[model samples]
Target: MQSLFERIDRLNGKYNALVSLDRPRALQRAREADLAQARGQSWGPLHGVPITVKDSFRTAGLRTTAGYAPLRDSVPDRDADAVARLKNAGAIVIGKSNCAPLCSDLQTRNDIFGTTGNPWEAGRTAGGSSGGEAAAVALGLSPLGLGSDSGGSIRVPASYCGVYGFKPSIGKIARDGLIPPLGDPAREDSLTVVGAIARSVRDLALSYSILSGEPYGIDAAPQHAPRIAWTGEFPRQLMDDEVSSALEAAYRTLSDSGASVEKVEPPLDLHFLNFKYFMLNMYEFSPRESSPGLHKLFWLFESARSVFSGGIEANYKKLKADQREQVDLFDRFAQQFDCWALPATPTAAFHHQKSGRPIPIRHRGKSKRYSYWHATGGFAFLANFLGCPSVAIPIGRDRNGLPIGIQVVGRREQDTALLRTAAHIAERIGSTMPLAT
Candidate 1:
């Protein structure tokens, strides 16, 4: 356990995945854990394990700035609910990981910690806002990471970094200690969820069990092989050739391995989902950011725009009807398959671009202009959009030798079963893609 601290000292400078250190406190706790184990006392499953939490989630004595400059000195008196659970199970909080400012951007960069580079390649982004957590886990800085997924924060990073990330249903974990407290936590966190990132499916399962207070069998077996409905095609978008081909290979490998893998057009309509995700996400967070000076005015303008774009309580309630319809459609469609699988992103990690600019598609003969949000979250939004549980598992590397992955989603609130199915697939397919290093 102490070696991890030494590793942090040796390697964190290059990856910049971890932003803070609780070395003394964490080492002390690890020693205690070792003593307890010697006496045959166990705190729980994660005893003696060291982990990191995204800076967005507060840790009692650790500074949590959420990668925003103004909150650089902010430290909480209590851990976020999920972080507390991990500690209760004997997981030591080694440090906090870097993230995009205020958790608003899709790539990990801030004036505070600089940036978290992809472990697989130099200059490529470790997809954010869970970028640091994913990269940290991938690089062995931590065995597991606590992150949040609202608009693909967890999925994108896991896909880009060749790790496993599980985003449970929204109500699974409380949102009491988010860096910037949610305006009306229960409601505002509707689309966001606490998630776990790890190097193996079992780690995700174990972390999920501890975080959500639900049992996730690390080697749980299915009565029968899971039936999967998967696709590599997205409506109105062209997947980069390498990614599309990697997914196709995964589909074939899974089919040959005995899981009932079938290709079909899912009920997922990226066109409708992308817009709804934008409006609903805006309604959830638009006015909550109160950065001062120009930033404050910018958010104020956003609030006004929300009002003009239908953000009143009445309009929110109206959107609920749309939400209900979409949920129903997914629920109905999901009845035929045990789970759904698809590409986590259109492509593997790309070189860092100007923070909010559009990135054109990379496939030959295709030049559709795509926003950073669309490129990364087009497929990922479906899980958060319908409030479903999804797991991102690295399948293999793309032509660039960067990792590519798939997101397997299951029914909302049925998290354990989804992990089991994903684990089963992971085992059969060997989730043995090469390490980033």
Candidate 2:
């Protein structure tokens, strides 16, 4: 506990990864934990282990702003359900990590804590709104962090920082006290999920169990080769050479390890699915109310597309059927394949840029201008749209030495099995944890 505090004191200023810390309170709890241990008392698996949470999660007595100004001094008297579960499992929160203001943006920056720099490159972006959580985990400031993902928040940041992140099936982790809540909590089902970002898959598994009430099957190795399904490339998505090559190399490793890897296209149209995502997000999230320019324009474009395709009512029925098809098709997919493999994002971490601007994507003399969405799209939303489980595993790095990663997805409610498959692959391909140096 002292070591973690010392490291944060020494390095957090440089990274701005941690926004609010409860050092005094945390240290007291740590000492109490030590005394309990001395008396042979065990809190749980994570007893006395220090960890950090995304600032968006309300931690009892700890200030949580979600990077919004009005809530700067806000302190909740109760923990978010997921946060309480972590605390119940003996995970001590040393601090709260930074996030995008009100958890609205894709990059981590706000008036409260400035911006979170990528652990690999200071000038590049740390993906958000879970950016600070990933940066902290990667830089050894924290071993594990809780992140919320309605979009690509968890996986994108983990890929950017060369760490592991997991998003379990919808409602796998309770979501009562999250700031800028995405889905309607009154309902039992969810489109958003609370998940874990960690330096290793084992930590993610433990955290998942604590959060979801699942088994803590640590070091779960698949007994046989996994039947893997992957798109050689997603249709119409432009990717950097480095990112593409790294993924292809990972496929080679999985194949060499005896996995039956097959190239296949996504079962549904991606553009259509993305439109479904935007349509549903309109009601579930409120980011667009604050977002200007492109945010509004994207909504307008999708709305127009809906009208162009007959009408919203017509598409609503189509989408409802599509949702059912998503369930049925994926059930059969789960029977045939252990997991689906794909890149977490289209490119490796790029230099920090504004959200509405065009990004220059270049590789081996090929250069093109891409919108922010095109550049950041890593096929991540597929899992979110389908309510599937997804895990981002760092496989290699780009020429600029930034990390590259791929997400393996599993059927809804099969998070533990997917994680085990990921662990099996990690064991075969070797540990990809970034040196916190």
Candidate 3:
């Protein structure tokens, strides 16, 4: 059997998943882990496992660019809170994976390191923001990896690559070291979160447990089976045939498994949701005065548009406004059931170039526009905006053989139930196929 380091080295170039591989350090850690196991010393659940982190994470002594040119040489002096947690669990940090510029786009291509393609189909995109981590995990370059989801970053990649991704409720996991750390530091926001990407839903739960300091803490309660509201449409928006088909199949499987599944046409405004997300995301990038170039142009243009449309305040304010409204909506929505279900993305993995611009897509007698090209994450964003937990599990596949995933969303601080539901789905449908290393 090849060591994890060897496996990574053997497949790193094939997927372009990693921007920097810590070979010397990784080998050293593996050797230490081997020695510890030989002595019968134990660390934790993640002991001896090699993992990867998205480049946005601050890993001590390793370059973390967030895929920006100015930060290309930047290295953190300390690990982010999540990184420290995984390290404490005895997980080896092998390397940092690629990401979009400032982690703003849907595709993982930036001037600093170029692109990271899907392991399933080399010609297709792996999905963004967290695309690199998803690709790495899908290819078995790492069994588990950390990726942040500020609007479907983690789940999108996981869905596109046939892996598991989980975005826990805001504040359930510490946000102390997250990039652009939360303003309140302790308060959780709807748009930003640190999540995991893995080969199995069980792996996702395990990683979350270790990172959150709660072993086996994810609620796997059968009694908490939620009154699921399945929507093939994008909230109030449209959907694609591929997306609709995947969601329909997942609903059927869940219904077959004895879950209380129902279809509800809730009064939701998806176009506003898309615009709200664009406003907030653009505002996020505008403040980063670093990396002067097209990126600055990209942020400034969107930021200005948001300001002109909603008033020239700030992105944080716009996000807060949208979130406040979403919270109100959820407060009312919570009375009905435990959670909502939706397609993680309208379609499976596509060529990277096609995701470069926002466009309109149709599904189930609805036609709507996405404000940003990489707006496939529209459905998943609502859960994040409401500070709720959600897990993405592989459902089935499309005509082109791409993986389709279903998102199980729950109330804030209800991460345990969310993971449990996802695990249930995985157990029923069977987990997505694993990548060969």
Candidate number with greatest lDDT: 1
TM-score quality measure for candidate 2? 0.92
Per-model C-alpha lDDT, please?
Answer: 0.83, 0.82, 0.76
Which pairs clash in model 3? 219-416, 357-373, 358-373
lDDT of 1 by residue, 318-400 (tens): 66778878999999988888889988888889888877677667675666667777787778887887999999989888767
Model 3 error, position 200 (Å) = 1.9
| Root-mean-square deviation of every model | 2.7, 2.7, 3.9
By TM-score, who's the top model here?
1
Q: Which digits, one per residue and each the tens of the lDDT, describe model 2 over residues 1-437? A: 89888888888887889999999999999999999999999999899988899999999999998888778899999999998998898989999999987666678998888989988887889898899999999899998899998878899999989999999998788878988753343323346789999987888898999898988875665577777898757676677778888888888888887878898877667776776676555535645434657467865776787877877556656666776776787777667888888888888887888775766777545998777766774377778778999999888888888888888899888899898888876776534765555
* Cα lDDT of model 3 by residue, 1-437, tens digit: 14666777688787789998777887888888889999999878788788999998989998888887778898889999999999999898989999887777677888888888888788888888899999998888888899988888898888888888998877667755666541333333446888899888788888888777665854544766657777666444555777787677767887898877788765366667666765555544322443347557865775777766775455456567866887778767765766677778876776767444655555556665554443467676666566678888887777877888888787777676667766766777745685734
Against the true structure, candidate 1 reaches a TM-score of 0.93
Q: Give the TM-score of candidate 3.
A: 0.87
Q: List the residue pairs that clash in candidate 2.
A: 345-378
lDDT of 3 at 90: 87
Model 1 regions more than 4 Å off: 182-187, 286-311, 364-369, 433-435
Q: After superposition, how far is residue 386 of candidate 1 from its true place, in Å?
A: 0.6
lDDT of 2: 0.82
- Give the Å error, residue 336, model 3: 2.9
